[model samples]
Target chain A: MDSRAQVSIEVALVAGIAILVAVSLVNINFERLNLARELGEGGEAKMVATLIATSINTVHANGAGFELTLSESKLNFTELTDVDQGTGIILPIIIDNTRRKVIVGRNMSRTGHKGQWNVSVSMVPNNVVRQDPTARYPEVTIRNNGTNVIVYADSSKVRVVP
Target chain B: MSSNRAQVSIEFIILVGALLVMVIAVFPYILKTNELNKALSAARDGATFGAGIRGVGYQSGSVEAPPGRIKIKSVILERLGRCGNLECYRFRIVIMMPSYYSSNSSYVNSIRSTIRNQALRFVYYAFNGEYPASSVIYRVNTNYYSFNATTDVEYY
Candidate 1:
């Protein structure tokens, strides 16, 4: 081949290889960035789930002896006495529950992710027709981001009511 | 005829030499870039694992140790406060991978260095919290292969 033709071929080959390498590097970088984002999202979800579980356990152990009512929208531990409502006792319980949800929400919002969690308490009456003395209400379905968590409070379990 | 043949051979040799040089110079950059990307991805993966472990620990009422794959060095949990009426915990997880940092190649080394410093900070910011704006000291060996990490947690 003529010198000019040989030179043209060489230049074309070099350009082709460079373009190929450049394209490959760009693709690799894009993939890595995506993986990083996914990892961040997964981590946030797990944290939220943990907080939800702890709160339910605390409320089950200490909430005042109140009739448990479960509805589609609310789980009520009602009839809390004046003492039970005081900051000395109830504030910690409230704090425990609220904080768990808040952390989950804040993290999810910041990370642009979403998760769902729920907790509930219900009473099992002592008597069906006011006859049995061995029965008591127990808390149920305290889930942290869908992790099945069960915490029960036996009025019998309370040795010295605080 | 003999002289003409010799001239063609010399010209071919020159063309080959130029091609080899171009490949040598550019191929390393491409390969180095690839290695750096791989390390960055690994660092990000480790960070994600750290975050997940922290969350699990807070929920389970026990510190969930980071998975073995993550090579965690430390975990910190902070009690932040209630979310509405529920308790919350903030966790930090740190992991180390020696292979990522001790690379002799500049491309890999730069990426490894960047990831080592930024992984946790990225997680913290992603979680909507600010990281302390100070730089942490790191010691890297000649091969770019060792790492250390520290994580912090808060619960409310």
Candidate 2:
């Protein structure tokens, strides 16, 4: 082929590839920003859940009755059972990604969904505790119960059970 | 014809060099803008989180922390200061709540305590302890649910 013809073909091919790469890059950035927004929203939900779990643990630790208001929060209570008078709830912060959920801190986890997190503050059994973190206080086990696409918080204090 | 080709090659090299320089110069600005935006979003979310927990102290009946689990009236951005840093933002947030009783020192003290503790925790979590923040609360009886009570929040 003539030299001019060869140069013309090379320029065309390079231009085509550049355009393709540019288009793909734009799409990638768009998706990234969308994910960032989702992360922000999920992070917000996780923060609220952690706050509730922390409140429960704090109340149990001090044996003091206290109330906290959760506003603009898309969270629901399961069983709505009070932390047992003697055995406070122990909540384990579980992080699972097969479900694509990230738990912030040990007590809170969130996913891409705008709303779908469960925090359980349950009574700890005396005999069946896989690991125990407390001797003075009746242990509370806070963790995700079942698979409701949720995370559970069961702790007399917000901590990992030993 | 040979001279023309040489001139064309030099032109292409110059064009490529100019593009490279533009990218190197502009990339930092883009990164800085993105970081600033992130900081702003984090601040807004943090303020909202703190406002949501304003009532945690009021659940007890006695002066046992004195908060019967209060309500947040409103949260607004009072001022914002921009500084030269990767995510530089110094801002003030104002929070309001309603007062059933007259503005008493004891009641105000409880509220201040509630705001300080809960707000600090909320910001710490929401911002992931990434920024330095300080909050101050003041309660004043204006009228019947006329958006009363206040907390001054400073974040850097």
Candidate 3:
């Protein structure tokens, strides 16, 4: 082949490899950023779960008549930008009576990820946990009603008496 | 034609040299930043999980010590020991430091302090009760391999 042709082929091969590397790097960075975001969301979810679990345990431990109100001040559900409400229960917080644990999951539609980024913590209260069907967000009232810990979450418009 | 080819070769050599120099200069900074982020993330996760475990342990009043393990990136967290009383306890946080920071004392100290500060702050917020922030000690041991941080937590 001619010298000019040889040089042109060499440059094309090098440029092709460079493009491939650049594309790969971009992909890797994208994945890394997504993972970091997921990790962050998981951490936040854990924090919320911890707060809820601790409250349930504390209320149950303190005996009956002990009531704790977790307004936006305590349970910052805002931190969970895209939290899943779970199946059948329209509440983000789920009290698993069978497993004796509190599970907090994320809403997959907004997260754009398929990972199970839920946070679950074991609870001491074995009694049935009743959640207000109309419960929404920003506030949750947990009360030790002598037998079971009643948990209700709803907006300010709804009465939170437990 | 010969002279033109010689000039092209020299230009190629200079271009390659410049690219190498740029990579050499920027690679360390990127690595250092990555390490710092990892350390901070580890510290935060460590504190959060540590406090969560402690909270559960406090609730159950189990003297057997809560058995749990959390792995975050290059960090590992587990039960250290029982603090005699059920309310007081310790948990171990092991953070693996890359060899990059091992050679530089300042980097090691910076990473160590970063982990210590974040861990202490989160633990205090989540675990402290009547005890002051100062009372909760975040003991950090830095070797050439990893950062071993332990916190004496009290739930009141």
| Best-to-worst ranking by TM-score | 3, 2, 1
The models' CA-based lDDT, in order, is 0.36, 0.36, 0.48
- C-alpha lDDT (0 to 100) for residue B35 of candidate 1: 42
lDDT of 2 by residue, A1-162 (tens): 345764885698589769955653453344334334433443444454455445344433443233233322333232121122111112334333333222222111111112222322232221112234333222232222222211123343232332
Write the residue-wise lDDT of candidate 1 on B1-91 in tens digits: 7688669868887978997898798975766445434434434553553333332322212222222232444444444554444334333
| Residue A135's lDDT in candidate 3 | 42
DockQ of each: 0.06, 0.02, 0.02
Where is model 2 more than 4 Å wrong at Cα? A1-162, B1-23, B56-89, B101-156
Residues A25-128 of candidate 3: C-alpha lDDT, one tens digit per residue: 45334433433454455556656667878888998998899888887665655544434331211134666767677766554222132333344667877674
TM for candidate 1 is 0.28
TM-score of chain A of each: 0.30, 0.32, 0.64
TM-score of chain A of 3: 0.64
lDDT, model 2, position A123? 24
Interface RMSD for model 3 amounts to 15.7
Q: Write the per-residue lDDT of candidate 1 for residues A25-110, one digit (tens) a residue.
A: 55334434544443444343333334333444443444433223223233222321122221111111221232223222112212
Model 2 root-mean-square deviation: 16.2
